[model samples]
Target: MSYLFDHPDKVMPFFWEHVRLTFTSLLIALCIALPLGFVIAKYRKLQAPVTSVLGIIYTIPSMALYAALIPYTGLGKTTAMIGLVAYAQMILVRNVVAAIQGIDPMMIEAAKGMGMSKRQIVFRIEVPLAVPVVLAGIRVATVSIISIGTVAAWIGAGGLGRLIYQGLNHDHTGKIVAGTVTIALLAIGADLLFRIVEKIFSPRTA
Candidate 1:
């Protein structure tokens, strides 16, 4: 409490860094996942292999991944962001594939029967239908990123985790509490935000 109360200037910056890191990683993951998911989902045959590889990547421990990346990317933000992005891939891509694949085949057939081109069908029918499920995946991935972002501080990526590790090193209970509490709140905030979004898109709500 004292650490946070007395050091708002200090703690707040880290809080925002954590936010930035999380958003950046998710954005990157989404950009990559969205297209790749669509491609693999379209082919159908590609889905199993691509997702399997991503699943394996996600299973590796974050620390090991970071350690492996550090050699190539060096320490600091690059290494951290790469690691975060990699960990996020399995969740984002799988969700995207699931989202697109979950759409009713009849809806697609109707779109085609209406003389809709592939581009039109994709943009009009597929994208809208996929958004809610993708949002759910984003909600899950966001929390995962927030949790992983803490470990990122160890690599100098700079986030709330800095306070945590630093506190451990210095035996400062206040720093640990501040970091942990803020992280929990951030995760909760993301979850709720996406939940509202999911509800908005849901047919049930309409």
Candidate 2:
């Protein structure tokens, strides 16, 4: 709309901020989740308890999570990052465990037969084959984080959500539309990008 066009500078910065927050949170989540997931998957006794705990964290309301974090981290990117990472753990951890577990036993055996070390088998054989499913999880987690990250604005973590909140306060329909549209577009674009990356890394289909 003309209003959005007129406010391009104002809108773009907020949109980029939202992207930054979403991506950074996802990256951190991945770092934590991937190793934790692998450890969980490797240990039968720990898997259920760890995953259950993370799932419980995911079910907690976002506002409640932010509020709980505020005493330690205060209102800003730190709190937002904590909330986003917590939410992502459920998805990433589950997916990583499943992906590694779902790998064909024959493939692993073959890799081992080929004189592959344990690390080589895991990194080269198991991980490469699991790329599609792992990336699918990443796609889901990224989209979810982007949607929830908007709530971060309430705590002073600036993003497009801030625009939406401001628009709501001022009854500015145009700004609201701009912010909402930007988020939708971002979610869709990120989903597509991850899907493409998944396909590229995935083994050839017969």
Candidate 3:
């Protein structure tokens, strides 16, 4: 409480930094995942190999991935963003594949019967139906990125995690608590926002 009141400037800046890192990485992941996921889902044969590689990347420890990236990208947000984007790939790609593939085959057949081209069937029919699933994936990835963005502080990326690290070094309990609570709240808020969006895109059940 005291720590937060005393340092509103520091707290707010770091919180926004954390937001920037999380959302930027997610945007990159979505851009990469959507096209790749579409191709993999469409071809069928590419699914095993491509997703296997992304899964292996996701399995790597975050710290290890950061350490490996630092030599090339060096310290700062670039390296952190790369690591975070890599982490998001498996989640986004898999969900996208599932969403597109899960669409009703009958709907697709009908689209074809109506003389819709492959592009029209994909953009108009499949992509719209896949929105809920993609939003689900985005929700999961956002939470994960919020958690991971804390570690970005270690590499000088500047986030709420800095408070935790500083408090650990200086033994400032208030700062540590503030950082932890802030992150938890941020994750919860992001989850709720995405849940609302998912529901909006979800099919009506009535």
Candidate 4:
């Protein structure tokens, strides 16, 4: 607390860095997961195998993933981003698949009967109805990423984790506490924001 209030200039940049890393990686993850989820939902045979694979990838320790990527990405934001995206896949993909599947079959049938094209049905009916579930997954991922993103600093990605690491090395408990508290607040803020958005997107009652 003292460290944060005393050194706003030092702490704020790292806080923003963490935010940027989390949001950018999440955007990339959503782009990859959505289409993949669509395909998995469209093809029943692919669902089990593909999700199982993603689950395995997600289960790999974050540090291990970072270490593995270092050879290829050479450490930095790109490596951190890639690791975060990979970690997000299972949650996003599974929720997207489930959301799409949960869309009432009768609703789809009615859309088709109304002469709506497949694309139109997907965009107008399926995706809209699935928004709440997708947002829920995103909320979960965002909070997790905010917390884990601190590790990115170890790989030179430059986040609040850097402060924590420096604090640990220098035996500065105030810095460590400041960094930890900031991240917790970030995650909580993100979760609350997403919940609000989810409600806005959720299907309303008659």
Candidate 5:
């Protein structure tokens, strides 16, 4: 609390560090999930198998995942990023599949009747209609990634987790509180921002 205000110089860097770690992993995850999700949505047969694998990955604990990767990746940001991306796959992919699947078949048929090509239909009709739901998934992924990212510091990845670990190491309550509050604020802020985005693109709004 007081530590945050009193030492903005020190705290701010870690804050941004955490932000970078979280968003970078999220971007990579999104890139992977979006294409995979589209493919799964297009092919119903692949959905169950792909989802099962991601579900298994998601179930693994963050720390455990980091440790498991340490031997190969040798720790630091790569290991953390890999773990973060893996954990996010199920949530992001599931949401993406649901968002695309939830669209009206009649709408797709209408687009086809109008002589729209598959690519045109996907980009022009499906994507616009699917944005809100995809954003919903992104919101969940953002909050989750932010929370899990703190653990990255344990493996030398560097984030707000360093503060908490440092506090525990040195018996400093202020650092712990500062880290906790900062993370909570980040999660809450992200949720609110996504809610706004969701509302903006909502079908009801249209």
Candidate 6:
């Protein structure tokens, strides 16, 4: 309590860095995951193989992933972002595939019977219907990214994790607590924001 009150300035910047890394990684992951997910889902044959590979990627130990990336990407945001994006693939892909799969078959048939093109059906019906599940995946991915972003500090990627590492090195309990608290707050805040967005986009309840 005293530490938090006493070191507000020291803590805020690191917290902001954690937020920045989280959002950046999420954005990049979405860019890759959305299209890839759609592609894999649309092509039934590819679904199993692609998602299986992504799942494998997701399971790689974060520290090991970062260590492997550091050789080429060096120590910084790039390496961290790469690891974060890789981690996001399994969650985002699964959610996306599930969302698309969950859409009613009759609706798709109706669209086809109505002479709707593939693009039209996908954009007009599938995506809108799938948004809720997709958003849920985004929420999960965002939280995962925030948690993993802490590990990035080991490789010199700046974030609240730096504070944790610094605190350990210098035996500063205040910094450690501050960093951990800030990250927990960040995850909670992001989850709430996405929940609001999800509700707004969701169909009105009966």
Scored against the true structure, residue 22 in model 4 reaches a CA lDDT of 97
Tens digits of per-residue lDDT for model 1, 33-108: 8899889888999988988899999999999999888888998988988988888889988888899989999999
Give the alpha carbon lDDT tens digit for every residue of 100-190 in model 5. Answer: 9999999999999999999999999999998998999999999999999999999998889998899999999999999989989989999
Q: Which ten residues in a row have the lowest lDDT in candidate 5?
A: 197-206
Q: Write the per-residue lDDT of candidate 2 for residues 1-206, one digit (tens) a residue.
A: 55568999999999999999999999999999999988888897999899889989999999999999999999999899999999999999999999989988998899889999999998888778777888989999999999999999999999989999999999999989988888898999999999899888777869
- Whole-model lDDT per candidate: 0.92, 0.92, 0.92, 0.93, 0.93, 0.92
Q: Model 3: which ten-residue window has the lowest total lDDT?
A: 1-10
lDDT at residue 196 of model 3 (Cα atoms): 100
Candidate 3, residues 77-172, lDDT tens digits: the string is 999999899999999999999999999999999999999999999889999999999999999999999998899889888888888999999999
lDDT of 4 by residue, 1-206 (tens): 89999999999999999999999999999999999998999998999899889989988888998999999899899999999998889999999999999999999999999999999998999999998999999999999888778888999999999999999999999999999999998999999999999999988899
What is the lDDT, from 0 to 100, of the residue 57 in candidate 2? 98
User: In model 6, which runs have C-alpha deviations exceeding 4 angstroms?
Assistant: none
Which residue runs of candidate 2 sit more than 4 Å off their true CA positions?
none
- TM-score computed on alpha carbons, candidate 2: 0.96
Q: After superposition, how far is residue 77 of candidate 6 from its true place, in Å?
A: 0.7
Steric clash pairs (candidate 5):
none
TM-score of each: 0.96, 0.96, 0.96, 0.98, 0.97, 0.96
Q: For residue 4, what is the lDDT in candidate 5? A: 85
The per-residue C-alpha lDDT of model 1 at residue 128 equals: 92
Measured on C-alpha atoms, candidate 6 has an lDDT of: 0.92
Candidate 6 local lDDT, 82-170, one digit each (tens): 99999999999899989998899999999999999999999999999999999999999999999999999999888999999999999
lDDT at 148 for candidate 1?
95
lDDT of 3 at 135: 94
Worst 10-residue stretch by lDDT in candidate 1? Answer: 197-206
